[model samples]
Target: MHLNYAHATRFNPPCPPSQYAGIGLGPRMKSAERFAGHRQDLARKVHEAGIKNPQVLQAIATVPRHSFVDAGLHARAYEDSALPIGHQQTISKPSVVARMIELLHKNKQPLGKVLEIGTGCGYQAAVLSLLAQEVYSIERVRALHDLARTKLRPFRIANLRLIYGDGIRGLPQAAPFDGIILAAAGLGVPDPLLDQLAIGGRLIAPVSKSETEQQLLLIERVSSHRYQRTALDEVFFVPLQS
Candidate 1:
């Protein structure tokens, strides 16, 4: 299910206006301020769930989860639960997302470039943008791809690039990523993704243990010919698809 270069379409959102451009006052600002407390509370919950990285917790508190979901689901946005994002996909729970990202940050080194295999609603990509210097996210579902693009555009994340393609193939042209995170569960880590990891890089994903069970898996490239794999946390995620 690997897609060639022609099948992948890159979609980079327009840059946002400057923060100091006198755009902070208004109804939007007030609404965002209103959600600030909720975001903070969500971060605290994620922290309690065992995500020890302070930067990851800060990112959890900074990204407005409410904005990534529909207006009707806003009430539950900050809760540590997954929400439907159409196309039979659900946004990963806040605690799960935090945990995975924290695992990627296990080495305590700033990420250079990261790849995200699922961009449902672009929520995780937004959080990745805050941690990674560059982020390339691939989504196989065309509708979800467009949905994520639309939802993410308003935020104007400059470092994030959305692509509509087969994530199982991994982005070869952009190989040697410092970190890779997959939002879906599969039988195992795709070989292409493993090959794309740079030496000293880390990848976090969920591997299916059974039809109804999954466990978080971490792979770290220790050398050109060596990789270390570890299994952690029981979890559930939508199946990874090409």
Candidate 2:
């Protein structure tokens, strides 16, 4: 079913899949064959990187990473590195994606409705689709937002909603999310996002301590006004923008 949540009117829905056909994806490079081999290899690498969740591994393996990257760079799609998707942003590395999603799934109960900030090429949202009942992704850059909408439409992901807006503002109209993930790094977790979390919800993002250093931060809302924060591995990401 299509998600007509409270924030549905904030942005236009993605176009129908039919309109996305034949968009030039550059030279075809045997993506299906390469994806099959690379997906399995990436899954194995992610497992070794401490993401033990079987479902997370499967999602990583099932989604085509090459489909989310530039056709010219499809050859490196399976590599454990982030690739630029224009606009100074990069699709996060496979290991980071798997670990973050695995952390979200580790919450006390399964995730129902999840919010993802920075849709990028929509790869993370697609991965989240496999885990959450519904996924709401917001992107601040209109170009990237429009690109993601087109690139993702063919997938026909019904439970996913892509919105063009400031990621730091958070989507309060659809507040009380089961989990929230931020793809960009910020000095601190945005208060608006913390306020939007459900009582027992979890939020994951990269937190910057200085201009050059960052750490993967996970915050859990235990009570209405109380949150516990934990620092995970060091990581790098573009700064979160308003």
Assess candidate 1 and give its lDDT.
0.82
Q: Name model 1 segments beyond 4 Å from true.
A: 1-30, 107-109
Report the C-alpha lDDT of model 2 over 71-164, residue by residue, as the tens digit: 8998899888999999999999999999899888874333677889999998998888777776789998989988788767666666678888
- Scored against the true structure, residue 29 in model 2 reaches a CA lDDT of 31
lDDT of 1 by residue, 41-118 (tens): 999999899888988998899888987899999999999999998889999899999999999986564567899999
Highest lDDT: which candidate? 1
Candidate 2 weakest ten by summed lDDT: 17-26
Backbone clash pairs for candidate 1 read none
Deviation from native of the Cα of residue 184 in model 2, angstroms: 0.4
Q: Cα RMSD (Å) per model?
A: 5.0, 5.1
